[model samples]
Target: MSGLSAALLELRRTLDQEMFPLKVGDTASDRHALKELAGQLDDYLLPRLAALDAPLLAVVGGSTGAGKSTLVNSLVGAEVTEAGVLRPTTLAPTLVVHPADAGWFSGTRVLPGLPRSTGGGRAEAGTLRLVTAETVPSGLALLDAPDIDSVVKANRDLAAQLLAAADLWLFCTTAARYADDVPWGFLRRARDRSTALAVILQRVPAEASGPVGRDLRRLLEENGLGPVPLFEIPELRLPENGALLPETAAGPVRRWLEELSADARTRAAVVHRTLAGSIDSLDARVRGLADSVERQRLGARELADLAESAYTAGLTAFDDGMRDGSLLRSEVLARWQDFVGTGDLMRGLESRVGRLRDRVVAAFTGRPLAERELTAAMANGVEALIGAVADGAAERTVDAWLATPAGRALLEDEDVAQAGRLGRASPRLQAGAERAVREWQGFVLDLVRREGASRRGAARAASFGVNGLGLLLMVGVFASTGGLSGLEIGIAGGTGVVGQKLLEAVFGDQAVRRLTGEARSDLAERVRVLLAQDRGRFTVLLSPTLEADPGRLRAVAGTIRAHRGELSGGGAK
Candidate 1:
């Protein structure tokens, strides 16, 4: 069989068996698609089977008076099929199968929905009927059908069935009516599957033969029937020749039949080749759909990537903003200037701030910044802290520093602003930033004070006490030695206790203020610079530490770390 024939046969077989492997709904596209395929298969099979795919069927179809019965008689080499002047002689289908070849028609009932004929008669001759030809040899059959264009529906139906069954369709068209609409219409309908079509252009006129034959060939080619074998049987018109009916094999018609039957193998091969093309066409269409589906999948993947990137890119922007707004500027150096005061800047800053430690102890001595008050303050400070930390950010998102005391204080007090306008920074966020800043500043103050004392060559307290005590002691001695030696009395008279009182009254508060201010400022500046360098934003989150409850800031620092990480995508789900 040709590829097309094989494909159709296989497709029909599968349709007959595989209802639906996936059991998908009837509405599914695949299901609908398969149904369409089945419909196409049903339409294609008949013409294909009738074409020369198998030797069993060679449908002899033609119009009225085309000498169809005569051709059959010629093939049988007998008068078994009635011929001549018997217009519409085949009212009933006729079976002229050779005795041994009759078995192929026994299961005609399996054709499903088609009428069956047991042994037929002449009235039933060309009726819608099927019968195997006795001379079919092996792998061969012939169906002599009624006129397709006849007024009789039975004749048309009979012609249709015969067309459906024939393995080779010998489309017998007389030269006078080859262009008739009805017969060619049937041929076109089955063209997809049918193969090796033989168009017998019979009974042509002598004078008009050339133009007529050329027109027929052109018509056939235009209708996709170009390669169909063509045979010419010029008009006998024996009556016009003043002769009786012609004898067997005595005309061009017989020679055409002989030519067709001469090489059965080549005809079958041609039929199979035609069928193959059909299968290839279907495969190409299916693969085109597959490629289109693949393109859709690629588009989906690209969309997924874009969504993830857009969402994740926020963290990167936030980090860049925080880095820019950080408190590491020169102003930080000024706040911490005293820390580097009298020597190498950073070292001197450390030393001068240390001396301010004692004044720090005295300043907060009587009234400490209460824990409860400081806690509340810290809550506010933490808010201020992170708020300040994130201050000046372009796309600032961090809410509060969460270091309550420092955040609260910083918010109420810091020069800059930031993160939490949400409310206040939580005191918990600082963890330990408050006390850290204070102790840090206190240590520097102590160092500064010690350095100042050393510079003065003695402790200020010791000098004051020594001078006062010595003056009192001298006065007591002078008075007690009222009648003592003249030298001691003269020394007391020259310097006297009054001079010491004048000196003490003149220098007291000023000297202390001047010295303490230097120490305090020195320590404050140093602490500021250190905080900026080591943990500027951090210190902001733990502010007011030097004055009040520093513990709250200690709590908030941890929250800052956790939230920043989670927000940054560093933390796990």
Candidate 2:
């Protein structure tokens, strides 16, 4: 493929993958615009650019009951498309082309997304009916599109798609509904895209034609469509057979279309003009989509930051609980005191290091009941702290998300919120917290084993065993005197000092400090990891939106803009 085609193809791929899943600013409109741009690329720009020599497709589109099907039938002098009292007279769009031009419409060159049906009784949904008519000029084809204002959403969407695919739009509206907002909206779109257009004012009384036509023309001019052709078909009675309109009524439009078709240059001009306009319109439209992508990216970032902040605070809270002598209270304190006779240990902990060492050795060498209880108590305390921190983080993150529209939408999504998954901690978090604590305790035991590798250290460690030393290390971590105050100094602080001094006597003071610091750091690191897992629930929801790169979209738009001249010259052949 040529560079321009390759670039356009890349643009199409980008748009196809682009997402505005978040409920940010005007997201609904952004999604609609995205669909419209992608549809035009598939149904019109890419196909028409590939085959510019093909017949000019003039799609007849307008409000419901606007007589678009009747106008098309009258112009072709046959009922190739259905017309009736039904609200949506045309269910499936009908494309009328001369027998010589049947090959162009029969294939998948244009409107390829829609299925093609030749033997059309009534075309199925999303099917295009092809009808060959000798009355249609070879170089020009007319498509009778569904009502633009149909009550059926699919019909309205299909109408817009068909109109976007047209090289020329034959917008039909009755004189009475000429000023309606719906048709005017389409006319404005035609004006913006610079699509070649002609307005058919059907069902006009001769006397009212002048005033209505002038008013419609003025509205067109105000909407930047002043140069568009206007055809007025005066209201006239049809035959009993509900046949085509009188020749005089449809003659002007019929003659104009035929003359345009006979002149190859005119047909080419119409195709080229619409093609140029469509390509030129892409830069702004794509850039607008890029802006929406950026908004989604920013919104995702904001939610992620909120989650991160909540988890970070949770980590800080865990750290604070560890140091503030909080874990040293209640059951943990009672177990530690029971493991080492606290009454004597605390009273003389500061003065008698040697005696304390002997007492620690004797206590650890006995039956392992006290050691097991003390270790279990420490594990439970740590697990509880972690569980509380995770719960707080989950709650904070949920509350923060609920404050934002986009975040709330994601949290409320059925996939995210089913069974209330997003509003609280994961069901497995309690088990995860327990597992993490056990893992950290194992790490402390490993640290004790490694530290005891030296002959002298091993001799001292054997007196207490690795399990006893590991339990002492856990006590040192929780009962740190750094954040204690008041009565805590006498209770949790004194308890920690006993554990610290006992460790010092076993392994010199410096080693004891080093071991305590390592144990604390390891436990903190484990809690950090646990909190991060809890935070993942929120960030994962934002991942898809965050992955949409605005820069890629802008780059594609820039590439298209750089090739504007080439694109205007009818793209790469």
Candidate 3:
């Protein structure tokens, strides 16, 4: 193969592999058009240009019952192609080549996607049948394609595929159907590609030919197709052989085709004109596809950003819930009050100090049942706050996703919207909070033991007992610095004062403050990890879209567009 042919093959492979996975319906470009263009490149343009000197192929295309097959047979002076009244008589395309040029059409020079078949057997489906007729001129081949507007979808697609392979289009339409939209749609396409073309107005009534021809000519000229030669095949009678009338009826059409076939330069010019125009259109078409790819990337990225924002809101809301003193009301407040009465703890701060210390020590050491009850209430309160924040985040994320095109696609699956619902508290959350609280309790006891080892307060620490002192510290941590303000602030602070006085008795005021700060920081760190785990649920929903990077796709398209001329066999201008 030549350098140009190899380049074209590589380009075809590249087009076959290119994909844009994101589909945003409202803002999405027509992907079907991109697919059709790629099909044409692989089935027609690339293969044809690879062997540029092959026989000029003219595809006979028209609306249903337009007599394209009859014309093909008449031009070749034989009944080589089938013609009938069935809605789509030409289910499979038939290619007629001069006996001398049979090798050219029989080989895979163009339309390589369709399997080649020899006679008419098994040609009812998508196959091309090759036929040879001695009378047809050697330099040209004619393919009778299915009706452009056939009711059968496969026929319509096959018609378009055959037309794309043509170096010239010999369009046939009747006087009655000539002005129809469907046939003109194809003529407009031929004009856009600068394909060499001629039209035959078959079954024309002699009386209406003059006026109808003039009107049709006017329409053609208006549409930039005035230069195309028009031939008239008057309504003629078919003989017993089912063959067309004598040579006189088709003489002019035949002579024109023969003249084209006899001139090698004219045939080459026709092939080159269509080939170059098709190749040059590649960059713009691919650029359109590339732009669609960018829209997909943008849409997917926006969805990921929305998920991140939703989770960030959850984290912020959870932080506010912890410090607002809202969780310390009702059951939690009742338990704390029962364990240490509110009146005496707040009033006897400086006065009656010995009585307050004894009462605080008795609350810690003597009432194991009250300590367990307060701990249970605090854990349940923290768990409930965490669950509410997670639910709010899930709802927010779903609402935002439903508003976007890409998000709508995701929401089509009911499970995706529900994926973020943290439902009941996970076992992991309950176990994690429990473990952190236990560790902090242990840390408080160690603090007392270390500090009491060298002080006069050592005897006081022994009476308070590590278990009681540790539970007291746990209550003080809940009445965190930020968690104390207003009336509730005074109440929670009063509780803190009881715990603080007890600890300060054993370890001095400065040591007690430092121990509280360290214990609070450790608990916060554990809670931070728990919140991060919850955020992962939303991220999981967006994983597939985020992983498919459109940048690589756009880069590939850009590379192909920039080098398309070199890739498409030098056909690019």
Q: Which number leads on TM-score? A: 2
Candidate 2 lDDT over residue span 1-573, tens digit each: 556667788999988764788999999999999999999989998888777798999999999988888888888887788888878788899999999999987878889888899864778878999999888888999999999999999999999999999999998899889898888888888888889999888899989988998998898888888888898888877764337888888899999999989999998888888988888888889999999999999998999999999999999999999888788877876776677654554566465555655565677776478788888888898888888888888988889988999988887887676425556777888898889899999999998888888538678677678898888888888776566565556767655666677677678788888888898898899889888888887787888888888899899988877776775454467
State each model's CA lDDT, in order. 0.43, 0.84, 0.72
Which model, 1 or 2, shows the larger TM-score?
A: 2
Regions of model 3 farther than 4 Å from truth: 1-29, 77-81, 97-109, 115-118, 129-141, 239-246, 258-264, 325-388, 413-573
lDDT of 1 by residue, 468-522 (tens): 3222222222222233344433323222223233223333444433433453344
Clashing pairs in 2: none
Clashes of each: 87, 0, 0
**Residue 346, model 1, lDDT:** 37
For candidate 1, the TM-score is: 0.37
| TM, every model | 0.37, 0.92, 0.70
Q: What is the lDDT of residue 540 in candidate 1?
A: 34
Query: All predictions: root-mean-square deviation over Cα?
Result: 30.0, 2.8, 6.4
Tell me the RMSD of model 2 versus the true structure.
2.8
At residue 300, give the lDDT of candidate 3.
70
Better of 1 and 3 by lDDT: 3
**Alpha-carbon deviation at 39 in model 2, angstroms:** 1.0
Model 2 C-alpha lDDT versus the unseen true structure: 0.84
Which candidate gets the maximum lDDT versus the true structure?
2
